[model samples]
Target: MAATIEMPATRRPIVVAPMAGGPSTPDLVVAAGEAGALGMLAAGYKRPADLIAEIADVRERFTGPFGVNLFVPADASCAPERVDSDSAATGVADAEGRDRADRVAVEAFRDLLVQAAPDVHVPTPDWHDRDHYEDKLDIVEAARVAVVSFTFGCPQPHVVERLHEAGICVLVTVTTEEEAHTAVAAGADALVVQGYEAGGHRGTHRVTDAPNQLDHLALLPMMTDVGVPLIAAGGITTAGDTRRALGAGAVAVQAGTTFLLADEAGTTAATRMGLTDPRLGSCVTRAFSGRPARGLRNGFVDRFDALAPAVYPAVDQLTKPLRARAAQRGDIDGVSIWAGAGWRAAREAPAADIVDSLTP
Candidate 1:
């Protein structure tokens, strides 16, 4: 593989998108640096303590540049605005059958949440105000990490500025033009424009806001409004996809789904085994995290989409145990198997081989 990359140190454009709940391991981050691409340690699911340990481990192996990807804890989801009426939301029922159906769905959903979380990912440090956001930032700053990227939502302006003052470049993942604009206004150094095909959760700024209905090709053109260096992510499975995104005006392309099965990645045996099944394709479900994310479709999601609320961290916690139990038993019915549209393109060689092949 020609491991040649055309970007300079300051403009080291290619990024290995951080996939939480396994693939974003310390060794993988080191591999990215060796492969001539930047890597982000997925902070989306880790406790600050666990994340700190991983950060230290990466530093132990690779003294060069790397990044930390956090999930910006939404101010409101952890403490949602009171709903004035239940009739307007997901579980309004006028008929007995409808009521019964909703109840059955709710129980199934509880089961789904538990099943989905099996050592599954968390959206943030657990929740806002309590997720220890400040401490995590301070710890990463102490490590002198080169970049701090965020998903789920944009951090407060002051938080971004603080990391910037610490000399850390801040990149926020955005799924829509509106989000990109907001991130820029809030002090993002770069924008990770995530199109719908992105494997994990789409980082729509508003948890309530519906994700934009654009494919990568259509979405690529609209990112021009962001006014920052664009790094397109999601559904990039081949060298051709990479070429297309860069040609479409992305300064660099970010990838996650491609690394799900990489040798150095932390992907679980269940995910790797299920990927080869051919029966489990990808679909978006709010079952694991309160947010809608794409993952392998199985018995769990087949049973629980309608009852899963838009409410995130709460659902994330409520279902954690079940997901854990499922994974322990190697049951695909309950574990969250995140993947992108390019699942078929996933390879089994070492992450270094995969990374070297991707760069131009």
Candidate 2:
């Protein structure tokens, strides 16, 4: 039997979105918690040992409730199969053939990266990399964090049962009504309905499927019948946005872009400048990570968005060094400046102040 664990109530109807790749730092998490919002640590790209250290760091500074977000591995079998002329003529392509084609596409993208950023050394894609999913799960369950949220894909029923057994609540990010139903059936304690305007990667369950363009307000009403607590995400940047989401049936709201400029966030200087720059506009592009994510449109995105393949971590790995180099040099055009539609409204402030301002 699955053990029951209730979602911890926060002083405000706000959750600090777990912005992976850098923004979600221990200080930011602690600050969000102190300000009466639930802060989640992004365990997406970190090693298990590093995740353990972070959990300890958060525990030491703040005894308040927090959560950890994980990226479930994308199923390779479900990857979109590209049918070439030969396969098209035959009208039949086996799994092995499709796998080969996918590899070829990824390789071609790598070559393009090499050309685009000649100074950066792009690594070959580790096709089987699972982002240490199993190891991270073991670490988080052992750590016994208050909430465990998942993105990319839903965890298996047994996995959810195990987390429940550890007395940990589980939240699953869903971008559509179907995903919301799937998460509920998988025994999620809550749902984070991420909308089209969200910054960072869209949490679509299937890698090949284009994320739905439904805004959170329109999407939230469709989820009220799912029988789980709903946390609306996506362009939620102010107290008014919070009220609208709650009015739409969300118990709380999750926001990341609004806090990109928060004093405690680990957002890079280049990204900080990009977010505040008046000339840049936000758009969903696959240029940086192969996955569709909303960010400030810049030269890199303008040049590579159309050429990138739909292979994550693979593309993400290829661009990591280039992004790092750009950040080190404080070049906003070269780094991925992820931000939501409400990014223009974001201002530099302490996370606690941001949380207060977001609360009605």
Candidate 3:
């Protein structure tokens, strides 16, 4: 029988979820590590060189083991077909007199942006956005970080083998039991069982598939039979939630929303405002990133969720400028306030303090 994967020794069985965009920071990872929790650096939208630099920076601050999370590129079989250039430019309509969801949404949003903030310039969207998956993998192999996790999909077999050779533990985030099986088959050292309530992005292997609404606490039991270490993610707030996850056979609980307001996190002013604002509520919407992600519901999502296409990084790129402009203006309604259901419990304290409070 294959040996069971052993998680890193720590005072608490809590892991700080890697928050892409800006929340995951070196200080945040270092603080979590110092407090006896595993912390992850997000490499989703980073340049390979920049990712390496961030790794070096984290090592400088915290000597303990930490993790790096990467967004695996969409497999060719599942890559979204690019809409025709002519149709995209002309905003051609079908027999029903409705243009493609992606084109229409982009145009409408762009027009709104132009009217809302005429002086702000929006950048053109890149239809192909892989986030440099292969280059980032090479950096991880060279950095020799103790743990490397993949979201969006399981890494290819050879990539897993290479990381394993370098003494790096491979973790694959799976939103379903089927995805868990696939990751185990791909030789993943551990499984991050991300449930429907996970903030940011659902780690489902297929972007086209709608995420099944399963609580991570409930999903933990389903993945225990996978025979590997399971890290439960999503809506873990109080010590009670942690105990429940451990009771269900999860070796650790991963919490992102709980740490969104951590002092060390790079969460922006607008995002922090939205997170703490009592009026704000959370829901899953594909408007911002073109993938199902849980976040504080806002005007942007309300206006575009139904019209946004299932094309990721493309949709992510399409909305970048608008989000950037909104962020610059400190407009909470325009920025993507990615948060899980447990966001209300997030506290504005040191990452270590948050770790201590959650774990104990």
Candidate 4:
């Protein structure tokens, strides 16, 4: 285990959750640090070189402690079975049949996308892509930032050992008590206790499992015995929310939706409009990413939520171009506007001011 390094939350008790796909930026990270809070750079969708550049940028501008968050790729065993040539030739009605069914579902969804967004270029699903997991691991280890966090699954014990060897603290996001225990057994230094109310992905270990609808406050106390530092996440927006989480035994509180409107955030105009629009409500759906995430309800979600498969990066990749085009056109009905349950409280401000407001 790493020699009991101090958690950044021990200093300020406020952490900016790493919002991947644009909202998290170097300026946001610096602003969080400037306000005596910890900010994390999201590494989910970036290339290793891009992650390296972002790390260098943050280091150059802000000397205070920060962190990088990575998505642990889903294991091959969890993936849908691939259709083999023999199976296709034989027309087998067992495992191969199931694989074929899965493929059909994905293709049907693609057809729907093509029909709805004729101008957008939808690509074929990359079933085997691991989101460059190995390369990003190397980059993060070399960077030796103050902290590193993992979502989607717990890192293997050896991976944790290696990060500890490099003098880095490791945190894993977990949505349940069982997950918290698993992460601790895997040598995670702390657990980011994510509730169903959290914006973006649910951080469940298995891609296919539906995340439980436990609110962060209701879930935090259940994890108090896990013997690691606890960071509360999910819909935390106000000073009252922060204090309640800390009182529930969280060493800190991590907020994502609250910072969506920050000046430094890379949130698109469509997402901004969705956040403030009273007509747009929020719900958890797999329509956009194939993994259950909470975002503003829109026409795309209404059209595709029930049809989206459980395959993640595959579904995420398939919808990427369409979402980009939607954002470019500033069409709120077509983009994923991720926000927490307390999204109504979000307001435009400097990240430092936002951090200060959330600080209890």
Highest TM-score against the true fold, candidate: 2
Ordering by lDDT:
2, 4, 3, 1
In order, candidate lDDTs are: 0.74, 0.89, 0.84, 0.87
lDDT preference between candidates 3 and 4, better one: 4
> How far in Å is the alpha carbon of 150 misplaced in model 3?
0.4
For model 4, residues 1-360, the per-residue Cα lDDT tens digits are 556455754357999999998999999999999889999999998998999999999999988899999998866122223345566556456555656776787888888888887878899887678989889889989989889999998888788888888888999999978788888888889899998889998998877778999988888889999889899999899888899999999989999999999999998889999998989888999999889999889999999999899777778888989888888889898899889888998899999888888888
Against the true structure, candidate 1 has what lDDT?
0.74
The regions of model 3 sitting more than 4 angstroms off are 1-5, 76-120
Please give, for residues 271-340, the per-residue lDDT of candidate 3 as tens digits.
9999978888989998888799999999888877787777677678767888998898898989999999
In model 1, which runs have C-alpha deviations exceeding 4 angstroms? 1-12, 76-130
Better of 1 and 3 by TM-score: 3
Model 4 alpha-carbon drift over 4 Å, by segment = 1-4, 76-101
Alpha-carbon RMSD of each model: 7.3, 3.3, 5.5, 4.2
| Residue 171 lDDT (model 1) | 83
lDDT of 3: 0.84
Which tens-of-lDDT digit does each residue in 28-66 have in candidate 1? 888888877887898766789999999989888887788
